[model samples]
Target: MRIGELSRQTGTSTRSLRYYEQRGLITAHRDHNGYRRYDHDVIHVVKNLRRLLGAGLSIDDIHQFGTCVRALDLDATPCASALEVYEQRLRTLDTKIDTLNHLRANLAEHTKDLRQRLRAK
Candidate 1:
């Protein structure tokens, strides 16, 4: 099918599809008329791209997924590469959470000190 058909089927913009091509997330062959033609398998790939992007995965992260990205479908199973990326992201989020909790505790103590000082005044 053509880029337009793929876009309509996946509900993704043609511009995004082009960008995905440029980023090496997908590929399309040019026809004699210079129109971009994609394979039927691309429909699933595009859907996975949108899902990964929505889940906060970067293009680089998707690239890291390699063939694993293409393997995504209705099946609830994610490939090992996908698992690695998610684990890394989880660790990063955990670090951020710990930092925020430390800051919150410090702010609470400061607020308590200010309240006690105001009462003394």
Candidate 2:
């Protein structure tokens, strides 16, 4: 299919698809007219890439992970440095969760206070 069709089917924008292609996350073929042609597997690859990006992984990390993904070997112990990177990501997620929970608690308290004030008024 063409880029437009892939974008429409995947609910993704053509620009993003193009970016993915530029980033080497996706590939496309050229027809006689030089229009880019994408394979059906591109859709699944794009979805997986989106998932990894959503997980807060950087493009470099995604590329590295993609290698492992293709190898189908998850058991190989990574280097100490890689483990440190994973640990840092874990810590960042923990901090983000804590911040979000604090924000939720504050919002709940403010809502309760506002309701009480309205009732008193």
Candidate 3:
């Protein structure tokens, strides 16, 4: 199918598809008329890409493990690299959560102090 059809089917913007192509996250072939053509399975790939992005995976991270995911979907083959990537992302998320919790605690303390001062006034 053509780029427009892919975008419509995937509910993704044409610009984002182009960006994905440029970023090498997705591949397309150019027809003789210079139109971008994609395989039908690209819809699944795009959906997976969007899901990964929504999960906070960067384009670089996706590039690292995307082929593994595609193989798993298309051939029922599993790749160990995907596990490594997931583990790394989990660790990163855990660290971020710890930092955010600390910040929230500090913010709560400051808010309590402000509330006490307001009560005194």
Candidate 4:
């Protein structure tokens, strides 16, 4: 399909698709009319890329594992650094959760105080 179709299907912007191509995470062929044509398999790859991004991976991190994987003749393992990246993300998420819980408790206490003040008034 064309870039527009891929964008619509994947819920990604055309620019992001192009950026992925530039980052070596995906590829497309150029038609005679200069339009980029992507294969059906790209949908799966794009979804995986989206998952990796959602998991807090940078483009550089994805690129590190992507290029070698794309070369059909080679059978390289996935990037070992990904485990560290996932661990870091998990740690960050844990910190955020703790911070949010603390804030929620503070807010709940403030809300009770406000209720009591309103009742007194």
- Model 4: clashing residue pairs? none
The top-ranked prediction according to TM-score is 3
- Per-residue lDDT of 86 in model 4: 63
TM-score winner, 1 or 3: 3
lDDT to native, each model: 0.90, 0.76, 0.85, 0.78
- Which window of 10 residues has the lowest lDDT sum in candidate 2? 68-77
Off by over 4 Å in 4: 1-15, 22-24, 38-44, 54-78
Model 4 per-residue lDDT tens digits across residues 31-112: 9999999998787678767777876777876665544334333223455555555677688889999999999999999999
Off by over 4 Å in 2: 67-88, 92-121
Candidate 1 regions exceeding 4 Å error are 72-78, 108-121
Q: lDDT order of candidates, best first?
A: 1, 3, 4, 2
Q: What would the per-residue lDDT of candidate 3 be over residues 1-121, giving only the tens digit for each residue?
A: 9999999998899999999999987899999999999998788889888877888888888888857645526336666776777789999999999999999999999999999999999
Better of 2 and 3 by TM-score: 3
Q: 19-121 in candidate 1: lDDT tens per residue?
A: 9999999999999999999999999999999998998888988888888778657257558888888888889889999999999999999999999999999
Residues 1-121 of candidate 2 have per-residue lDDT tens digits of 9999999887888998999889888899999999999988777677766665777877776665554432223345344544554677889889999999999999999999999999999
Q: What is the TM-score of each predicted model, taking all chains together?
A: 0.81, 0.59, 0.84, 0.62
Backbone-clash count (model 2) = 0
